[model samples]
Target: MGYKNLKVSIIGIGRVGLPLALFLENLGCKVVGIDKDSEILRDVRKKKMSFDEPGCAALLKKTKMTISPSIQSGVRGSDYIIITVGTPLYNHIESDLSYIKSVCTDLCGSLKGGQTIILRSTVAPGTTSYLKNFVEDNTSLKIGKNFGLAFCPERLAENQAIEELGLLPQIIGTEDNFSKNMTNKLFNLFGVELLFTNYLSAELIKLFNNVHRFTDFAVANQFSVIAEKYNQNIYEIINMANKNYPRGHIPSPGLTAGTCLRKDFGLLNESSSAPDLFLSAWKINEHMPFHLVNSAKKYTKIRGKTIAVLGYGFKKNSDDIRDSLVPKLLRYIEREVPKKVLLCEPNIPKKNIEGFKNTDLNSCLKKADIIFIAINHDAFNKETILGKIKKNAWCVDLWNVLGQKQLVLRYN
Candidate 1:
């Protein structure tokens, strides 16, 4: 089929699926986004993006892609069906496959011969094999002969999804040669390199990639705690160590909880044996907010002080707050019984920061007796924001965005 005639139905037009839909639509594919969220469908109909993703807003404004709430309608005549629904972790640190299971069951009615079903969500190992059997059991279709089934994991970063979708190599994992070739043809339209593997390996690849990053971030967070105990600057020490050495490129410390990093480690450790390294990393990263609050308490009293929390987003410049550590930080701050709390997150929409006393950067900085640069957004420029802060305000900057000598700084 020609690229223009390639009908692609994307289930769950969320952060992952929306970007992919926009990119494929822009790539001359007939794209249709399937989302059960009425709010999301309404926003898509008005050409309004619900989240921050560079390069997708403009494409959404002029795109001809269809957005639908009905799974049957979305999958009726599409050549490719991509599942991008969320697979969140439960409180017990296990992968919750409820969303995935629901989608797969819904898809059985619409699944037909000659159509390729691709699971693009991050799932546990053996999920693809399970899905293949589920579909075969529900319908009379044979996997390799009648329809194609593949596990094509989405490896895009949140803010860079648009750019990375077309640039990053697509990984396709299939059980049969027929499914492999069909998936290859579909993703090859992106003009990126394609790596083909099996279902278990591909699933492990996604989890391993995220777990590696989670552990790497934990190392920095652990060092930050160690440096604070010694009354030394972790950022400065890292810079000194990595200045001329190729082997010593250590990342600086910050709150390191995001949707993928926070949950994927648990997903990997779900079935693994005890003495889990990922769990150790999780402990170190999860304790960062408490560490920040405790570290600040030593120098200044948080009780009855106006405190400003700058930037609530998990990542630096993105507005995605799922699994962000900011909420945990806010909870810690609340326990301290501050006189007033002001939240300032430039990237997040004001509507999203509800139930909190939200304010602009200037006002937040001017009124606060204590400040925490909770997220190191690029907009929190040290040169500019430093001028507006109260001279004697006790600032806790774990990211060290403000070139302060230490984590806790009290400007005179």
Candidate 2:
């Protein structure tokens, strides 16, 4: 089908779905974004973006697609229903499928033949197969005969979704030929490579992509801890090791976390026989905040001092805070009995910040006795941050964004 003739409905128009909705709408597809959140719906109706995604804000203003809070009405006449709802981990590290189950239940009444259902959320293995069976069992439609279902994972990084949506190769996982052909034709419009696989492989592909990066980060974090024990500079070591050697490419350590990396480890190892690898990586990365606090305590006193956390977002250039390590870092700092804690997240809107006072960079720097560069955003560079802070203030920069050459240092 041609882009102009295709009609698509995207469910859960948050980080994942909203970009796809705008991208498809830009392609001349009749797109409808469905979200249960009334606030998100209101923002979309007014062409206001609730979060940050490069190049999406301009597209949002010109987007002519329909956005509504009602799932049934939004998905009624759509040729494709894409589910991008979040699947987070519970406190016990088990995969939570309540969002997926709820979406499927609400979609049962709207289930009809000749419609392609694409799951764009990151999920555990067998989730797509289970959802395929669930849809067939709950509705009168049979897969390949009247209905189509596929698992096409969203692999775009936040803040790069607008560009990557059309650039990255798409992996389509389906059980039958009907879904395979439908999704193939749909994603082919992007003019990128397509890899077709079964439902389980596609699910595993998404999980593995994140788990691999998470484990790599753990290696860097562990190395940083070891370097600190001997008072050696990790930045110097990494720079020497990787400067001219092609085989020596080590990632610098920081607060390694996000909604996907932190949770996907548990999702993959939840049922797999090899759980130790994931558990070890999880421990190493999770211990970073505590390690930073303990290390700072050894250098200078955190008790009754103002502590400033430079960035709250998980990664740089993104405003997504879901599963960010900044909260855990805050909790650890709070236990140190600091008199005040100042938060400065430039990417996140002031209204979205809760339970803490969001201050400007100058205010945070001036008031802070100790500063922790939790995230390495470009705005927190040496020129912007170094000249502003107190000359004698203790700085803990895991990201090494300030060009200090050492993890913890003071100008004096």
Candidate 3:
């Protein structure tokens, strides 16, 4: 039951699982990362990363942990079994619990009596409780008696996963004290404060965090539209309003999206009785992709012009594309039938995105007739972009965050 000499198996070795596995290994635990994607396992074993994140590349290089695709070989006889699979949004918008339930069902087959299984994936409000029942029924073993089950929400942002894992307070809850204590001890090894609560409360905490962030962005996005009507930029206005002003903190307006931000909204809506605000925020964020496309067409016909989407990843320094507005913007622009579309995301590898000409910053700057700054990566400066872009070529700064945070509202 002690931290050292513990065996931890993390199911689903994507962004969340990989870092968690590495952290556990750093804590002197023997870690095994199991995923069905052989490509991910190959990249991980070879120290070749599929995407870029803060502190991920260096950590992957030095990791001596076991990574495999076979669940029996990876998870069997483990002291702790952790599920970090996704609850992705499907049909454009709805909680698809396929991955979570599938992972749980598979995990039940590999469960060792007395081993602890932690739910670290974001889920609907009652999912943690439901998992306890599902595992008991499937395994024919009592959850609290035969094994420990805890819902420990994974709260780290993609780019800041490593730092935040140690810095941010972790939320964990279980039916019995044994699982609760085990989760706390495990997270404590990561150098974080444990915020213990009930199972459903912990699950809701994760969903609520995602809901609030997107809703706040929706408010900022609405302000952006209103500012445009008055020949003003909302980013500047928000900055000016928040200048040393108490209770004036507001997130900047931009492409409001991400896998968690948009997907969790569906889970929130399904779980909550009053989902009006959540639904509204989703609608507003959903409209933003088409909004950028329509705004860009106001300049010239795109039928034969080459368009360069400067950044397509969900956010700056992130390679996750789940529910990102950049792809939606691309889909909408495809209807406009541009001569060609070039995706210019230096952080994202070319293999992740298909069909589009994924090129470097230099090539995109030279070839584009219309340039849309979809994401505000640190590398792109407004002056530097202006220096690179062809004069008289249209620039549609959707995030309005090229050289600076404010986008000039005057679009002509």
Give lDDT per model, in order.
0.90, 0.89, 0.80
List where candidate 2 sits over 4 angstroms from the true fold. Answer: 1-3, 273-275
Candidate 3 vs. true structure, TM-score: 0.92
lDDT of 1 by residue, 106-131 (tens): 98988888999999999888888989
After TM-score superposition, what is the CA distance of residue 75 in candidate 3 from its true location, in Å?
2.4
Candidate 3 regions with alpha-carbon error over 4 angstroms: 272-275, 299-303, 403-412
Ranking by lDDT: 1, 2, 3
Per-residue CA lDDT of model 2 for 110-222, tens digit only, reads 88789999999999888898788888889999998888999999999998898998999999999899998888878877778999999999999999999999999999999
Task: Quote the lDDT for 291 in model 2.
Answer: 93
Candidate 2 residue pairs that clash: none
Instruction: In angstroms, give how far residue 236 of model 1 lies from its true place.
Output: 1.5
291 in model 2: Cα distance from truth in Å? 0.9
